[model samples]
Target: MTITPQNADDSCLINQTVPTGVMSPPSEYLDEKKQLPNQNQNQNQNSTSHSGEDQESQKGRSRSIEDATAPLPSSSSSDRGDDNDNNDDDDDFPEGGLAAWLVVFGSFCSMVCLYGLINSVAVFESYFSTHQLAGYSSSTIGWVFSVYLFIVFFFGVQVGPIFDRHGPRLLVAVGSLLVVASQLILGLCEEYYQILLTYAVLGGIGGALLNVPAYGVIAHFFKRRRGMAVGVAATAGSVGGIVFPLFLQAVIPKLGFAWSTRIIGFILLFLSVIANLLVRSRLPPSTHPVRILPDWTLFKDLKFTLCCVGVWFMEWGIFTPLTYIVSYAAAHGQDANAAYTLLSILNAGSFFGRFLPGFLADRFGRFNVITITNALCVVTILAFWLPAGDSRALLIVFAVTFGFASGSNLGLYPVCIGQLCDARDYGRVYSTAVMIGSFGTLTALPIAGALLEIGSDERQGWLALILFAALSYAIATSCFLGARVLAVSWRVKEVY
Candidate 1:
């Protein structure tokens, strides 16, 4: 008698499709079912008293499933401990504690190195266009960041399983080494190919390794408050985004591109050390087999599948503004400081955007909060950004509001996926969805760049990108609404 992910027998998983991806105990995994009293323990013990070894094993297995949320019993526990223990801490997430907070801090530091750079990619795009790869077209230069983002998310499918099996230590260590090297080498890169290798390939892979575990470790520490915990850690991205651009502005002129990048590498080196020391998981290693290949069958659940599509569209829309805002402001005849300031303003709004919505999501429901944020994203892009031209006031307003609306996208998407899957499967399920969304990240900025190229003039090209961004968000909003309606069956008041 054995249990594996392949043989999940929960009534919710096998008997029929869970419409909301939720149900009562023994049949579903939800926040409400984290702890339960085992009503059948006495009957199971009595029935197995004189039973043969196989019967005893079978009895233990039954008790394990029926009382899955209860503490693991002494008899035959090891045989199926992985399945039970995986959910053991679903209810046990320390709402607040020193060690848990330390892990959050460590994740924050990791994100500063990972997403922090991601948020500042526009600076690199601007610099490379004017400096090292000046000969390349904007579309060609756009490939660098697009490929970088693609690697970070696409390799997430592999990183998630490895984190589940082995934890984050080795992954973070190797990732740190690679990321540090990429930054150091990037300072020396002048050719298109060298920049591609160092920034896109090397940096991207390192980012993937660090990003998943940084998030997975947080998932290990907090469940009920995961949205907020993740949101807080995610603030490091905005913080980094703000810090790096300003740092680059000051240092790039003084130290030149080479020394500025090198200094950033040193900063990442310092942060990585802190992250490695503090980040560790409380949960025991998962015994279920790791599947590097995605489980495509999960998409059969239409709600979950649509959620993935929604994220795919989200990246396409959100990244365009992030990468182009600096250039857009510059095109309006702003100085260097003014241009970078707008990007900083966006990141500043994102700082509040992550934790505030996360706090709201915990009380309001992840799906509900994210849908509102996405709608806000559509409005800000269309109403504020599309028409904001040379007017500094309008551009500043657009940057702040759009950044707020899209800030929750990163933190809450994982929270939404968590609501749809078993606690134990969060990492894998989330990474798979990200992998599918990687295609959008891979092409988004490049396509926007190409659109910029197509216009008769630079302003016309940017106008086209603005329209594309709004349309992408509009489509994404509809997909998310469809998923929510399917999950809650038109009950808009339902907390999801």
Candidate 2:
């Protein structure tokens, strides 16, 4: 990772994909130029003196045209916004177009269907504990959501390759069916095992199927504008987070769980229709299709290793607040409606958090912006969330501030990964890192719930959960900074 000055391409800056220094002309071309002069000299000596002057002028013109028309470095072309073949090379990405914007919109809809429900896990967790799955330990209840999250992330290992080799239409179509089916089935589950199967297992698989393609497709259409595009797509998660919870809160009492879930299923069906229509691969299939397997050799690079680990700890920490924010409010004496409202307010802040960071990350450095956001995550959790006891205002402020800071976890992580390697290798690397991070999601909620069991009282359990989340984010921040230093040293202004 310690690059020398002459090796400018070794720098991890976002768009520095090719060499910047002037290159020497090929030796063969140099020799041809050399032989042309010698041939002219020989001809003049051998009795072609009259035509020598004309030949010399023609040679000079030929060399001038050769020098002028020679290809420059790929980095220069990329920066100049030159559009090349969409199928030929990742460097040839069309930065934006009507078709590309449609893909982003489709991705937005996908996020709303998949991640939206994830954001509403708190509503389900709280409702199940008090109603259908009453008398269950928090740990048992936590598994339902954890499994959903783990599958959402873990299954990308396989989906990424399939999307790379086969394209996204089939994957999105099937995923849409499964996701809609899971919701419709969820309406009828009255028992614990039934709920687990419908909501967690089935929904998890469906999410994995669609979610990977939503992200993987974007890299096909963009490179320079990727962070902004991803940010815009990711905001749907927050929109879903806010909308699902509020809708459930308003209607769950009036219509009950069965009817509420059925309505959500119908809503998802409409969105999936859009995703199926618009999301697709603009690039052709990979020439050497990457196998559906993890590349163990990637760990050799210290920066990438840290990137993977940072995402793991990020998943471990971030979901704690998102999953338990509603429950915490209710446990601490907030009104039932106010408790659900807190989740909406939190996601409202997240709406901006996801959106603005990606736009900023594109202008500033991806690493710089992400590192700052992770730091904010740590500071907000320890400073505002951990200390907010029964004070409604403090909890509300924590919800908004922490939500804003943590929203970028999904929005910008892949962009940060793009900083580590060339665009051609991006899909594989991102999928592998996400697969590793899935372990953290699988275990985080259950572990947080177990921490609840160890506490003597509800208040102690809540504090322990808060402390765990804060510590995890602190470690994740350190890892991100470590990766940043390896990539760009201590230059805070360098955009990676």
Candidate 3:
């Protein structure tokens, strides 16, 4: 069937509501089931003679379902038969091989440009709120970043389907242009609305476009090693997170914010260009038509639906700390510059946090790893961050530990969702989750700002913020447990 953009999006929403196994039932089975009763009766009369053919057909259907549902296996008997198999070596991921590593490298570069910029948004908020956009309320400026995040996620509802139909090549190309343009324009905008339109809406759209391709391509290359592959690629965001803040610190002083932003835009241009070239899907081209709409029906699967909810709440709580950490430090007698530096420290820890835990997760189970990491984020926030409002040492520790723990949220979320459906439907599944998550992104920042407004002191704001983080963790934990129940109910010792 031709999966048009609209149909693809519709499918994404549908995938959420329906089990992938049911939606794309073995096409062969559907075809066979449609055969004439006369043919069936003839086959039944010669049942013994046709038994081998039936068994072979059944085997083929089973293999198709397995490939659709899980990581496609590495080897096939066909590999030995294809005389002109130029792709023989390319079929299976090399795991630690140079090509796989190169893909990982490319993925890292992509994340640095996309996720790094996202994590560093707080630095912009901290600086902009007190400087050029000072006339605007914190709530208004918060909307700028919030809108950026929302578009980045919301637009994915469309981008994911397109990626499924066409490979990442064209989408990445257009996204690269949009992102670079948004940055260049953002450098020139001095007005509140201009910043809102350029940075929040435009940059967000570009980021969203870049994001799906960045992580989605990993699925095409590696299956068994997917967790580690995605984790390694995910670390690029932390690299960007660390790099961009340091870039801002140096550039803002010498060139000032306007030119500094322009320089960063140029850097994004370079990275996005490289990303456009390198991040590619190894999977054969999809024959599906271009469908761009989100399929809300995918939520019908209680496990996936719960996962979407968990991600929504997780993202909502995530940016609260990212956006507010510097401001919180500044309010607590920390130097403004020093306060901004704390984000960098947190991102630095996030770098390793994204990489190492993925390796662990591959062995321990995706849901299990995510549950533990999320718990760590909540506990660390409550134990260290909540009380460390005035203690620079404690806050720094919280930042590093939380960064490490939370890093998994970004890296493993896609894989966790991927676990529930067929490989071909991954784009739809992921995009649908992000569609729901878009609402959370839209509201998280503004809500955090409102929380700050309610408190007399920033310390109280920190408490409220930490509570938000903990609540999200609790919700995420329940979702993970529910998924575990669906797959392997109440068996605590059983690996998810």
Candidate 4:
């Protein structure tokens, strides 16, 4: 009846019964002792020996059921200490280094290509209205850019999940080809349908493919300093915004729209190559297939839902100015070159706005900075832009001020969303939010264009459009404030 530790695993032990006279302690008591250092070895040895007539009976009973049931002792604390060290190593991040910054540089290049074009939509709008597509209504021309913006964001719903499963290389490389091809083909389009098919559909799809991974890759190398890193990359778009308008203005006169677009296409080809080389995902791919799909259940989170709503409104108002400022300026009496300069000036202010708020968002709080900027967007539109009319100085001020205020809208949305979930799920969450926001971008511009068709004069129509944009910002600011309050209480000092 006596059981030894060496015989513990034997099948014979399973049916053995202890004697009735000797009682065994409960399993829980022995389980607790098993957690202590090497004590189970002594307890086992002691239980093996018994004296007197009861020796045989006691021996039978000492075949401890608790010892049989308990798990084997864990490895020494020194071994566990090594395990802890290994875990710490796994969590370590390369916050800033040459490789990390190179990734940032790659993202910057990609943004310049994607966002630069997005910001320069006004230049194209102005040009098409006055030249090639002059017979088309403004609302009709508006669809080309609106569709482009729509595809750029809406397509991310699929591209994001693919990036999560496959990584960024192929997506970006393919995107580079499509974007460069779009630009090259864009110069050849003489008809309205040709322009829409070439620029809006093809260019938009390319931008979507390039844009998601560009921003997504930054999150991989940065966590603590992500705001600044993302900010730096986002500035490339504004720089592109500034440079493209000026480039188009100068080249369209000299080389004509066709060759000018081809030149820009060549520049984009070079930038896309850099993006394909530099922008890479640091994290391992998700093994779960479900992870690669949009989880609509995430919208159930009230804070996230509110954040998306806020972004939707922000996007609704944002592109209205970017798309119309040149037209607005020209309509109000500014000459062609001056109107294009105004677009560049807006982007110039945005170049600073993109990075500075990002630098501060890391310290002050992403939502805090975003909320403040959103409020400022409302103020600038209502106060500065709406009343400017033909006043050249006032229009310039509005362009710069509104540019600075709204620049954070694009840069900070991803940063703010990153705060709400695990880094691995960032692609899904971010793309889903943007997909929803794309509706606003798709509708906002055309609506503004239609609004421009209203009223006795261009100024009256523009005033209505400006008021609409201001109202959208006001709602966006309120939603962001609500999200901020839901995430972190009204405690004035919290750094969330």
Number of the predicted model whose TM-score against the real structure is largest:
1
For residue 342, model 3's alpha carbon misses the true position, in angstroms, by: 0.6
Give the per-residue lDDT of model 2 (tens digit) for 1-496: 2211111112223223334453433444232233243434454344334444533322101122233224322332222122211112324567788999999999999989998988888888888989998879999999988998998889888887777778889989999999999999998998889988889888998999987788877877777677889999999999999999999999999999999999999999999999999998865565436686777766777777898999999998899998888888888888789999999998999999998999877666566678889889989988888888878899989999998998898889987775554444456667788899999999999999998778567878888998899888888888888986775566544555
Write down the lDDT of every candidate, Cα atoms only: 0.79, 0.77, 0.73, 0.78
By lDDT, the best candidate is 1
Estimate the TM-score for candidate 1.
Answer: 0.84
Relative to the true structure, candidate 3 reaches a TM of 0.82
Candidate 4 lDDT over 84-174, as tens digits, reads: 1111111234667999999999999999889999999999999989887999888888988999999999889888878877889998998
TM-score of each predicted structure versus truth: 0.84, 0.83, 0.82, 0.82
How many clashes in each structure?
0, 0, 27, 0
Tens-digit per-residue lDDT, 136-185, candidate 3: 77777888888989999999988888887777888788888888888788
Model 2 stretches astray by more than 4 angstroms: 1-74, 77-91
The digit string of per-residue lDDT tens for model 1 on 1-496 reads 2222211111113223323433344434333332455555666566445444444233202222233334422232323232343333334467669999999999999999998999998899888888898888988999999999999999999988788788889999999988989999898888999999999999999999998888888877776677888899999999999999999988888889888889999999999999999998766565447887987877887877888999999999999999988888877888878888788889999999998999777656677789989999989988898888888999989989998999999988887876665545556777888999999999998899999988578778988999999888888888888876765556555554
Tell me model 2's lDDT, rounded to 2 decimals. 0.77
Lowest summed lDDT across 10 adjacent residues in model 4 is found at 5-14
Return the clash pairs for model 1, or none.
none
